[model samples]
Target: MDYLDLKYTPKEDIVCTFILKGKEDKKTLSSKIAGESSTGTWTKVLYSKKELNAKVFSINKDTIKIAYPLELFEKGNIPQLLSSVAGNIFGMRGIDKLILRDIDFPKKYVEAFKGPELGISEIRKKTGIKERPIVGTIFKPKLGMSPKQMAENAYLVFSAGLDFAKDDENLSNQDFCKFKERFNLITKVLDKVENERGRRPIYAINITAPYDEMVKRAEFAKENNGNCIMVDAITLGFSSLQSLLSKKWGMLIHCHRAMHGAITRSRDFGISMLVFAKLLRLTGVTELHTGTVVGKMEGSKEEVVEINNFLRKEWFNIKPIFPTASGGLHPVLMPELIKILGKDLMITSGGGIWGHEMGAASGAKAMLQAVDAGVKNIPINEYARTHKELESAIKSWKGFEKENYNYKIKH
Candidate 1:
C-alpha cells in the first residue's frame, strides 16, 4: 500500500505531523505510522482501498506529515477523529518513541464545531480590563473545604483586586464541597465583591464530572448567574468539552490541562502540548491553560510563547482563546512574565498568593500591584519601593528567577 501522495490537497483532510523514532528509515516508519493510524494492518489484506489510507505527504528527518481523508472521519465527532488520528499508533512495536508534534485541522473540521462562546475580547469586555494581563488566584487548599470556606477565601481574593478566582482542578462536587451549594455561595460572594469593587469578577467553577452531571451543574451555575465553567479538558476528553460548548451557555469555558503531562512531557514520545492546544481551541475552549515559561512546569519560554501565539492567532474566524500563565507564579514574576508573554494573558498563582506572609487578601493586592507595575513598564523592585503589598510579596517570594533552571532551545 502506498502512503505517500504529495500532489493531492483535499479540504476534507486532516494533516498531522509526528516525530518518529525507530531503527527503521524515516520513510518506512512514516508508512507504518500512517497505516496503523488509519486503515492498514500488520499483514496486507486481500482488498486495498486508496481513500481509506492515510497518506504521508511530507517528511523532514524525524518529522513526518500524514494527511487523513475526510470521509475517514465522522462530521463533528472529536472522539472519532482522535481515535483515528491520535489513537493506537503510539503503541507500535520497535518504535522506541512517537510524539505527535502538531495537527492542521482542515477548515471543514474547524467549521463543524462552535468555538469559544466568550473569547478573549468578549472576556476582556466583561471584566472591563483592557491592556493588561487579567490577574487571578486559585482557591488554595485545593480540597476538603466547605462551600462557605471556599467562598470566603474567594471573596478575599476578589475584594483585594484580583479579576478572577477559580476552584482547583481537583475540586468539583465532592462531599465537603457540593457543586450547587459551592457555586451559589461563591456567586453571592462575587456579587457582593462586584458591588464593592464596581467591577465584574469571573469565578470559574469546576464543572468536570460525568457528562450529564456536568451539564446539570452548568445549567445550575448559569441560573445562579455564574460567569465561567471549568473542565479538566484532557481528563474529561475533548468530546465532552464539545458537548458543553454546544449548549452555548454564554459562559467562559476554562479548559484546564490537568493530566496532560502524561502525554506531553516526553521529548521523544506522546503528543506535544501544541497539538492539544490547537484541538482544544478548535473544540471551542474559551480560556486554555498554557504554562508559564518561568513557572514550575517543564515548558520553555519559546514553547509556551508558540502555544500562546497559536491560540490567539486568527483561524478562519474562530475566536481567540485566552492563554493562562499559571503554576508556581508570584507577584515578583509579573514583570518578567509580561516581558515574555505580553498583555494578553490570565496570570494565575496558587501557592504564590495563598502562602503569602500576610494572607490571601494581601497576596491578591500584591498580584494586582505587580501587574500595575508590569503594565506601566515600571521595574518591580523600583515600584515596590512605595507599594507596601508589592514590597511584602517581593520580600517573601523569591519568584521563578531564583530557581536558576533553564532549557536549551533546539533549532
Candidate 2:
C-alpha cells in the first residue's frame, strides 16, 4: 500500500515564523524550492538571527509546505519528497526548540485521516439515538470500592441502559482496587449486558501514567478486553501520545484535558483547546472532552460547540473524533447538551449516579431515558412514562425556577 502524501502544497495563505535559538543562516536557508510549477509563489526569508519565516497563500502545512503543487517533488513518495524539500544542509545542530508557529491548511490537506471509526452518524445509528445524545456515568472518588462492588455498580448502569461509562481520570493502581482486578470485574458485567441486553457501553479506563508506564496501561486495557482507553493526554505530552499511536494500538483514545485550561482558559493569550484538538487528532486520539454546555463547567455553549465542530469537520486525512461532554453532568441536562453539540457526542455524569435515590442502577436508567428524549426531541418530563426515575425527578424540579438555573440534577 502506498503511504499518504503530505508535502504541504498549501492552497491557502500560510505564514510560518520559527522562533529558535540556533544561528540563522540567511544566505543558505533563504533559497526557495519550486513546487509543481516553476510559475508559483514561493518566498522564504531568514531573519532575527534565530528565526526562519516563509509565506504562501493557500498552502498545505502537514509535513512541509510547497507554494506550488508538491507533486513536483518526486511524483509521489511523501516522506522522501518532504525530506528533499529541506535538502541536506547545516540542519540546526544545537537547536533547543522548533516551533511551527502557524500553518494555513489548504482544501486537500484539511482531511488526510478519516477522523473517527464510529463518527457522528455511525455512533448515533449504532446507539439507536437520533435527535438525542448518549448519556453516561463515571465511577468517581477514584478508589476504595472492592472489585465485586465495582462490578455490581457497572452491572447496575449496564442493565439500566446508559450509553457510555468511564473511570475517573485519577482512577489507577489504587491499593484497595487493583487495576486488573477492577478491569476483570467490570468486563464481566459489560459482557453480561451485551449478552442479555445487547447494550455495548464504552468503558473509558484512565491510563494517565508517566511516559513509560502509560504505554503499559494502554496495552493492559486492550489486553484485558476493554472497549477504549482514556488518558490525561495533556499530562502525558503530545509526543508521548504520538509514540503510542505509532504502535497502532488503535483503541478508542479518550483524551481528558485535565490541565489544558492553564493555557487555553485565557481568551487573549496562549493557544485554544481547538488547536490542541487538531494536533492530538494528528497523533490519532479517538474521543476528546468538550466540556458540558449545560453541566458544571466554565465554558459557554458556543465554546463547546466550537471544539466539537473542529473535531467533526472534514478536510484531509485527519479523521473526526468523538466529542465527549462531561463535568458535573446529569440526565436532566441531556436535551440541551444534544442541541448544542449534536448526537455525535459522549455524555458523562458522575456523582449524579451514586447520589440517586434508588442507587446507580436507577440513576443510569434516568440518564438513558433523558438520552431517548433528546434523540426523539421529546421533553424529559414527557419521557417519564417509559422512564419512571426520570419522570419522578423531572416532576419535582420541572416547576421549580432558578434565576440562574444552577439547580443540581441529583436527588
Candidate 3:
C-alpha cells in the first residue's frame, strides 16, 4: 500500500506529530509507521486498497507529520480514534523509540464531540469571581476520613475564602466516607457559607467509578445541590468522561490527571500530557489538571505554559477549559505561578494549604493572599507583612524554586 502524498491535503484530516528514532532509514520506517497506523501492512492482503491509506504530509529530520482522513474516525469516539492513530504503530520492530507529540484535530471532527459545559467564564460567573486565579484546596489526609470530618474540613477552607474545595483524585464512593453522606454534609457547609459571606464556593465531588455508578454519583451530587463533580480522566478513561457529559447534569466537570504520569512522564516514548488535555477538552471537561512548573511534576515551564494556552484558546468554536495547576503547589509559589499562567486558571494546593503551621483555614488564607499579591504585583515578602497566614507560610516553606531538572525519573 502507498502512503506518502506530499502534494495531497485532505479537506478534513487528523494531523499527528511523531518523533522517529530507529535503526532503519527514517523515510522507510516513517512510511511503514504511517501505513501500519492507517491501511498498510508488511504483506498485502487479497483486497489491497491505496486511496484509503493515511498520507505522510511532511518529514523534518526526526519529526514526521501524518494526516488521516476524518472519515477514518468515528464522529465523536475518542477510544476508536486512539485505536487507529496511536495503536499498533508503537510496537513496530523497525522503530526503537517513538513519541506521539501532538495532534492537529480537524474542525469537522472536533465539532462532533461536545466541548466543556461550564468553561472559564461560566465558572467565574457562577463563583462570582471575575478576575485572579480561582483558588482550591484538596483535603489532605487523602483518605480514611469520615464524611463528617471531611465536610468540617471543607467548611474551614471555603469559609476562609477559597473558591473551591475538592476531594483528592483517589477519593471515590468509599465506605469510609460514602459519596451520598459526604455530598450531604458539603452541601450543608456551602449553604451556610453562602448565607453568611454570600460566597458561592464550589465543591468538586469525586465521581470516579463504573459508568452506571458514576452516573448515579453525579445524579446524587446534583440532587444534593453540589455544583461540581470530579473525574479521574486518565484512569477512568476519556470515553467514560464523554458518557458523563452526555447526561447533561449541568454540573461543572473537573478532570483530574491522577495516572497521566505513567504515559506522559517519558520523553522518548508514550504520549504528551498536552495531547491528553486537548482530547479531554473535546470530551467536555470544564476544568483539567495541567502540571505546574514550580510543582513536583515533571513538566517544564515552557510545556506547562503551552498546555495552558491550548486549553484556553478558541479552537474550531470549542469552548475553553480552565487549566488547573496542581500537584505540590503552595503559597510561596503562587506569585510565580500567576506570572507564568495568568489569572484564567484554577490553582489547588494539597500540602500547600493543609501543611500550614496555623491550620487549614490559615493555609487557605495564605493561598488567597498569595494570589492577591500576584495579581496586585506586590512582592510576596511585602504581602506577607500584613497577612499573618502568608507570613506563617513563608516562615515554613521557603524558596519556591523547583528542585532538580530531569526528564527521566530517578527512582
Q: What is the C-alpha lDDT of each candidate?
A: 0.85, 0.61, 0.88
Best by TM-score: 3
lDDT of 3 by residue, 254-329 (tens): 8899988898888778998888988998988999999889988879888999999999999886899899999888
Ranking by TM-score: 3, 1, 2
1 against 2, candidate with superior TM-score: 1
Error of 3 at 285 (Å): 0.2
* TM-score, per-candidate, Cα-based: 0.94, 0.71, 0.96
Cα shift from native, residue 166, model 2 (Å): 0.7
Q: Candidate 1 lDDT, tens digit per residue, 151-206? A: 88988888888888888999987888898889889889888987897986899999
- List of clashing residue pairs for candidate 1: none
- lDDT comparison, 1 vs 2, better candidate: 1
Runs off by more than 4 Å, candidate 1: 6-12, 399-411
Clashing pairs in 3: none
Worst 10 residues of 2 by lDDT: 31-40
- On residues 326-394, what C-alpha lDDT tens digit does candidate 2 reach at each position? 776666777777777887777788866666666778778777777778878897766777778887556
